[model samples]
Target: MNKRGQFYLVATVIIVSIIAGLAVISNYSYEKTPSKFYPIEQELRIESAKVMDYGIANGKNTNDLMKNFSRDYSINSDSDSSYFVFGKEDNLTLAGYNELNSTTIQINVGLGEQAMNFTKGQFQAFNFSNTGENIKVIISNVSYDFKLNKGQNFYFVVSKNIDGEKYVATNL
Candidate 1:
């Protein structure tokens, strides 16, 4: 039989169940890791250009900017990114690779016979002269080619890993 207060009791139970489900969901989310890195890579690309410009205007070189940005990002973001920033006109090359960690990823930056590899959180510049040639990059076994424009043209390759998935972005 339907009682006057019975409906109110059923409604209250339904509301409480919904709220409890939401609470469980919220708690579960905080324990899981993401499976993608493109989102982080995109945000870095947008903000990094501004910072790079500021650094260049202040007479800072690409190598310096790359090191500083990598350091700053490691300090500010939960995710880690490996980066290679270089100008085509700059006759400098420094390349090193370290094992990946929670704060490190891998990227190979190359021009002709000159190749530089970087691990996240490690900043070392290698200097080599370019004889009017172009450079290409390989990420996750995929090769990409791009033209290098004239005069102080700086490029960046940022790579990150999440849940065994790797994502990379470039400002070319």
Candidate 2:
């Protein structure tokens, strides 16, 4: 083959390789997954359940358990901000705030018939008690409902914003 023909063929191959590399890099730049924090969330659920079991065996109150679990989980996970909603008996506690990916994503928190809506990055920790009724929580168009009993029952929710969408991991 002539030198000129060989040079042109090599240049075309190089150009194609560059374009393919750029395409692959762009796709890998941002990835969105519904279960962004699945592993961490599963760990949260298991640990919380164990805490509850220990508290029950020792006849400890939910308030103490909630406080310790919240603090320890926040530190150990080293994750973004997250709010917690959990309690037993007539008490339901909602604490901490979860960071949002965008300012337009809707956030809602509910307990029983009362529901509070907050804008993105506008969430605040709040607490209230129930009157032997069902507890309801609505977050980013998703709804979670639970019925509390006399036993050491608790519910924990963790949400992470992934590409402007809310992905939640919960122990229900």
Candidate 3:
């Protein structure tokens, strides 16, 4: 081929390569931002049963356990008076007064969507027996931006309580 033709060919090749490189680089940069990312599975909701179980299992003191419950469930009940449990519907609400602490009611419920909606309501108070079954509770609150769906994005916090004692929170 002639020299001029060879020069033009080389120039054309270089131009094409530069354009391809620019495209790849732009895509790489766009993907690096956190707003572009998304999680695989749906973010799970904190179940009432898990919270009760955590409270029963890990709580160190009554106050501590109730604190965990209050924060996790956004409850306003006094620490010593809060109770949470899951069981039959018959013996759900039982209020008894104690001199050491305020009068506390005990209610046992299910661990499903209905219970979750109920707990998320205005009744931030809890009532459970301080006796046989030690209940533990785990709760997760997830919120996201405009683009991502509620469960699709991954900005969330988890709070777990056991026996009104050990409580822990984590971000995932």
Please report the candidate that would top TM-score against the real structure.
2
How well does candidate 1 match the true structure, expressed as C-alpha RMSD? 6.8
Q: Candidate 2 — which residues are off by over 4 angstroms?
A: 1-36, 75-81, 100-112, 115-125
Tens digit per residue, CA lDDT, model 1, 35-77: 4545765776666667667877898775566556655664455
Model 2 worst lDDT window (10 residues): 103-112
Residue 44 local lDDT, model 2: 75
- Count of backbone clashes, every candidate in sequence: 7, 0, 34
Q: Between prediction 1 and prediction 3, which has the larger TM-score? A: 1
Residue 109 displacement (Å), model 2: 11
Against the true structure, candidate 2 reaches a TM-score of 0.58
By summed lDDT, which 10 consecutive residues of candidate 3 come out lowest?
Answer: 144-153
**What order do candidates take by lDDT, descending?**
2, 1, 3
Greater-lDDT candidate between 1 and 2: 2
Error of 1 at 161 (Å): 3.4
Best by lDDT: 2
TM-score of each: 0.51, 0.58, 0.33
